[model samples]
Target: MPTHTDQVPETPRRRPPLGPEHRWVILGVGVAAQASFSAMFSGIPVTAITMRADYGLSTGELGLVLGCTALGVAASDIVWGLLTDRFGDRRILLTGLISTGALLVLMSLAVVPTGDGRPPMPLLAAGLLLAGVLGGSVNGSSGRAVMTWFREGQRGLAMSIRQTAIPVGGAVGVALLPWLAASHGFRPVYAVLAAFCLVTAVATWKWLHEPDDAPQGGGGTAGEPVRERSPLRSREVWRLALASALLSVPQMAVLTFAAIFLHDAEHAGAVAGPLVVLVGQLGGGAARVWSGRYTDRHGNRRGYFRTVGALSGVVIACAAGLTLAGAPVLLTASALAAGGVLANAWHGVAYTEIATMAGARRAGAALGLEGTTLFTVGFVVPLAIPVLLEQSSWSVVWAVAALAPLLGVPLAPGRRP
Candidate 1:
C-alpha cells in the first residue's frame, strides 16, 4: 500500500479555492478523536487475559465481553447520528469523547475486587452500558466531523486515516496492555487508557470546530441549513449495511479468535498471541488506507467490496487448512498476515460508499445503521464460535466463516438496492 503522500494526483500542485489557510487544526483534532476511539476498541486485546482470570470465563465468554461492547456500539450509533444531525458535530464529538472516557474509567473500577473475591456483575453491566452508549458514538461522530472538514475527493483519504486509528489504538493496547496486565494488573491498564481518552477529550473541547457553512453535493441546499437524512427509509442504505454486516463476519471471527487459535490450537506462546494480533491489525490498518484510495480511483466501491470479500475467503481457507494440518509456525503466521491484510482492507471502501450514497446530511445515520448491523453480527458470530467448535470442528467453523463474505457477491453486482 502506498503511503498517504504517494497517493496524491500528479495533475499539479494547487491551492484551495476556499480562501482559507491550512486545516492543520482540523487534522490534529481528527487524529485525537480517532485515537480516543481507538483506545476504546484497542483495550480489548489487553483486557482479554485479565478478563479471563477475573471472571473465571472461557474463551467464548471472553469473546462475549468484547462482543457485548459491539451490541452497545451498534445500538447507540444511530442515536448518536440523529443527535449529531440535530445538535451539530462539535457537541456530539465532545460528548462522545468525554462520556466514553468516564465510562471506561468506571468500567475499570467496577471490575476491581471489592473486599471479597467475587466479581461485580451489576456494576460492570451498568458501566458497560454507559461505555457502550458513549463509546459507540465515536463511530458516527468522528465521521460526521470528517465530512464537515473534507471535500468529496478528500474524504476517501481522510476517513481512511481515521480508520487507521482503530488498529493503531488497538495495537497500542495490544503492545501495552498485556505487559501492563502481566506486571501491574488491569486497573493500571484502565487508568492509562482513561487518561488518554480524557486528554483527547480536552483537546477536542479546546480545538475542534465545525464548519459554519455546508458544502455542495452533500444532500443539503446551497442556502438552507443541513438536515440529517433518515437511513431507515433508504434502500441503498440498507444494502450497504447488509454488505458490511456480512463482510464483518470473517473480519470479526478472525480477530476475536486468532490469539486463542495461536495459543491453544497452535501452542505458540503468550508472545505469539499479541504478535499475531498486532501484525494483523497493522496490516489491516494499511489495507484500509490503500483500499480507500483504490475505490476512489475506480468509482465503483461495491465492486471492490465483492472482490476483496471473495479473495479474503480464499486466504482464510488457506489459514484454516494450515491450522487443521498443524502447519509450521512460520507458515501459519504467513497465512495470518496475508489473510488479515485482505480481511479488513475493504472497510474504508465500504464506508466511503455509505458516506457518498447517504451524503453528509445522512452520512452519520447511514453509518450508524451500518456499524450497528456489522458489529451486531460481529458480536453474535464469535459468541457462537465456541459452541460451534464444541459440537463440530474448527474446519466446520472456518467453512461457515468462509461462506459469510459470499453474501456480498449478490449485493456487489446488483444496483444500489
Candidate 2:
C-alpha cells in the first residue's frame, strides 16, 4: 500500500468534466468553423462590380453565378445532414472544411484569365457551385455540435452565437474582399479564403472533439427515444421551413444587391457601397445575439421570431418608399441597417426551435430540411432580383420582398394549425 503522499495525488479529481466552460469552447469552435465557410460565399456579392467589369458578365449572368452557390448548397444540405447524424459532428465538419479548402484552391488554379483578366464565366460558375456543395457541411454539423454540447436552457443563446457567424463573417468579407479585389485582384482574394478555410480545418481537427456523454449515432435528449422517421414529415418542421424560406428573400436581396444599389442608384462611390453592407452586417449580428438572449430568457422563440419578421417587413417597405422619395444616403443606409437587423434576428431562434423539435438525434436532418428550403428560395431570389430591377424599380423589388416576411407573421408557431 502507498503512503499518504504516494497515492498518485488521487488522479487529480478528474477535473469534474469541465461543466459550462466546455460549452463555450464548443461555441467558439463552431463560430470559427461557420465563419470560415460564410466568408467564401457571402464575400461574392461585394466583388460583383469587379467580376462584372472583368468578365463582361451581364446582370443576368452575374445573378446566375451567385445563384449557383445557393443551388449547390440546397442540393447537398440533406446529404451532409444525413452524414452528420450517422457519423457525428466532428468528422463531418473536418471533412467539409478540408474538402472545401481543396476545392477552392483547385478553382483558383482553374482560372484561365482572358485578355480582360477574367476567368471564363462558365468555369468560374462551375467552380463556385462545387465549392458550395462542400460548404453545406458547415451549417448542419456546426449546429448539431452546438446542440449536443449545450443544455436546453442555453441552446437559444448558443445557437444565436453560432448564427451570428453569418453576419460577422459577411462584415469581415465585405470590408476586406472589395479592398483586396481592388488592390490585388480576384485570384488573391480566393487564395486568402482558401487559406483561411484550411487553417480552420486544421484547428478543428485538433480542438473539436465529440462529447463523451453524448449519445452515439443519435442526438436526442437523454432517455428520449431516437426517432428514425424523417423530420420532413412533421407539420411544425414544414411550417418552420416555409417561414424561414419566405423571410430569407429579403435578407438575400439585401446581401446580393445592396452594394450595387448603393453604387448605381444612390451614386455612391465603390468604398461607400461596401461600407453600407458592412454596417448592416454588424447591426444584424448584434440583433441576432440580443434576440437570442431575449428568447432564451422569455422562452418564446416562436413569438420573437414572428415579431422580428413583421418588423422586418415594415422596415423594408418603409426603406423602399424612402428610397423612391429620394432619401439621403445616410437615411437609406440606416434603413438597410434596420431591415438587415430585423430580417436576420430570427435565424438563431428559428434554428434552435427546429433542433429542439427534432431532438438531438434528428437535429441534423431537421436543420438540413430547413437549409434546403431556405437556400432553394435563396437560389431563386437572386435570379429574380435582376429582372425585378430591370422591369420595375428598386422600390418595387423591396416592396415585393417585404410581403414575404409579413406573410410569415401568422405562420409562426403558436396555437394548433
For residues 120-210, what per-residue lDDT tens digits would candidate 2 score against the true structure? 7888889888888998999999999898888778899999999999889878788888788777677777887889789988878866766
Clashing pairs in 1: none
Best by TM-score: 2
> Candidate 1 lDDT, tens digit per residue, 1-417?
889888967798643343223245665676677766666565564456566776567776676676776677777888987777666666888888887777668767757653566465555545555666777777777776776676766677777777777777777877887788777766777778788878988887776665545554342313434545576787877877887787677667666776676677778877776777778778888888887787667666777788888888787777778777878977876776677667777877777678767777777787788778876876687688888889987767666777777766666535445
Model 2 weakest lDDT span, ten residues long: 9-18
Query: If scored against the real structure, what TM-score would every candidate get?
Result: 0.87, 0.92
TM-score of candidate 2 versus the correct structure, residues matched by position: 0.92
- Candidate 1 segments exceeding 4 Å error: 1-24, 114-116, 121-126, 215-229, 413-417
Worst 10 residues of 1 by lDDT: 14-23
